[model samples]
Target: MSNASRFKFFKSHHVPTLTVLKAAIGDFSYAPHAHEEYAFGVTLAGRQDFFSGGQFHRSPPGNVILFNPEEVHDGHSGGERALDYLMVYAHPEQVKPLFADVLGHERGADFRSRQTLIQDAPLRQAILELTRLVTSQAGSCIDQENALYRVVERTAQLGGHVQPSQVTHRPEALLDLAREYIHAHLEADMSLDDISQAAHLSKYHFLRLFRQHFGMTPHQYVMNGRVNAARAALDQGTPLTEVALRFGFADLSHFNRRFKRIYGMTPHQYQRDIAR
Candidate 1:
């Protein structure tokens, strides 16, 4: 790693599903991507710019960049200076418990941070403080949990928006069917027409509703599913080429690119690395 571009990833044992990253980027730009986790970060220096939720946004020092689960975005250093930032990713299950204390709700709610960029002093402090525990790995479980809880509360208090439970009811069942079809066919060539047919809807409406419910296009969902399933196969000591083929990746190079986008490493790296 050099000053031009560097990244360090850590898994937070305290919050089992929480992952943290500290990065400085100058030359590299991130591909448009999304995660299953609710993600937010604070710019530590320089400026960070990205597009999400239909608009471009900037996060300078002390500003928060928020992304709801599975929301697509691409990022890059905003100016001549390298971008320094700290990001934390937490799954819905990890964040839901905090909502009960923050918003008086249980884990059943769909948590969202509606704004793409938020400026809040308390939220920034909370985010930075939580990263201390994750990166340093010096805190007890209780200490780490407390720091994470504060971050979650501050985030919800400042930028949180919940998706309404009532959606177009008819679509929910149909979306599930479409999702299943996508997963089942991940090892095969899949098309919008094929998924829509499985869901019993026209292609365009199915596309719209799929994005509305899953926060990603069906194609994005398929790619993510393929990468995820391939990761699982790798875990079971499968060969990289076989894993890629089984998951329907056209070839090793294609699999490598897709895997890196999601897991931050090539399939070979992920398989060989003992630390994640």
Candidate 2:
């Protein structure tokens, strides 16, 4: 389907609860589009120029940008310099609890609405680490989940919210429910089309926005998650073949191939190495 035609919002399990993308470009431009849920990110290198809320914004590294759901916006690389940035896409439900927990308020109350720019060095570094962990396939599941947790918790803290957002509060309020679905079923056979449909987007548009916002495509996110899960299982001496099937891989060979590709060693070797 056409990109525009896929603009409708949806709720499904294939979408990411959180995804991060890191991009370096001489020039990049995103045409007008609106998400059914909230979008937020930080520029990490050079500058980003975008039109949001009827004004042109030039965001430099260390600046955060938060856009309300369904806000029309466009973006491009600024000036003659290249740019790099990290972005996160979340459901209102995911974010709402953070605000409620932090602010102790009823749902729908704005938590410093519009966009926010974070210039603190320590905060910037922490955000970058979350993005890195989400995109990288190297970390253990415990490490990766902790990293993701940090991202959410820190964002809540920085945004000054009182409560941790629950996955169920706004089941129909935003696209985050779809993300929760992905998190719960990460080990199963999942597809981009499946995720796109969950978000009420076509595969192409979903891929585009998913990459733009999260920094990693849905496939990469799933692979990274699987790698993390496998690491924990392997470290505990789960049988290689069983690990493969338990994580929904087709067989031991497929699992071994993927495990080696991400971890730089066979499953048995990985277990042995980790045991040392």
Candidate 3:
């Protein structure tokens, strides 16, 4: 919310698979966080600094930054000047279909980007054009999809992936039950004990294991589920007030703030955009 930072997010009905972020930051700093999607960033002006893959990086103009899914990192401006950049986020569920032709599903899903920082003219161009298409919202569906694929392919070419090794983690049934409980009781005032009890685990154990497995807390998961359900209802022309109440938001203002945080727009703004 600082004056030194700004973020504009754009997602199109034509290309729902990718979300574009246009950002300019000077004094603000990002807390360490990771995304569930692949993110590619291009620096347009000034300098940007971030840490990822256990390395510190400074990206100047014309540089591209790549972050794989669940890659923990933080970012901010590198100097006195603001950092102008564009980032494209591609979800795995959407991107997996695109990789079938280029790298096959098995290899592509396993693929990880190794270059956290680099200067690649082709990749940078694709990303810039992608930001243009998504933000402008003035291109054909085919055009947008083509641009997305071009970026994905160029990114895949910068590969640092091998056959992913086997891994073991928590049992899915407990988490599945927990998620079911959250969705089933969206309108209820659920607490940590409520959810963890539904999962049949101790509160602290469930909290730790859930975050480790899902990258988000139990409350965050519930909020996300509620927002997503609200989105669906809005698409059905449900009244804003009804949608908020149905989703268990504290009030219209609370709904507005939380929805904006999740979808990058208030409910009213989102409705208007979808209408357009």
* Top-lDDT structure, candidate number: 1
All candidates: TM-score:
0.83, 0.46, 0.71
How many angstroms is residue 181 displaced in model 1 relative to the true structure, after the best TM-score fit? Answer: 4.0
Error of 3 at 67 (Å): 4.1
Q: What digit string (tens of lDDT, one per residue) describes model 3 on residues 1-276?
A: 234766666676686647777878867676555665789899988888987766789999999998887676778888767888988988877766666556766656667777899788999999888888888887899998999899888877876674343433344568767877987998788998999999888988889888766656787777777886787677667999999998888799999987766444578876665554
The clash count of every prediction, one per candidate, is: 0, 17, 0
Selected candidate, larger lDDT, 1 vs 2? 1
- Each model's lDDT comes to 0.79, 0.58, 0.77
Once superposed on the true structure, which residue ranges of model 2 sit more than 4 Å away at CA? 1-16, 106-112, 138-276
Tens digit per residue, CA lDDT, model 1, 1-276 = 234776666777666767787878876777677776788799998889988877888888888887887688888888768899988987778777787667876633566777778888888888888888887776899888888888778777765567666556778988888978987888899888999999999998999899877767888888887886786577567998899889888899999998877555687876665254
lDDT of 3 at 266: 78
- Candidate 3: residue 241 Cα off by (Å): 3.7
Give the runs in model 1 whose Cα sits over 4 Å from its true position.
1-3, 169-173, 183-189, 208-217, 228-246, 262-276
- lDDT score, candidate 1, position 134: 82
**Better-scoring candidate (TM-score), 2 or 3:** 3
Error of 1 at 111 (Å): 2.3
User: What's the true lDDT of residue 144 in model 3?
Assistant: 88
* Cα distance off (Å), candidate 1, residue 150: 1.0
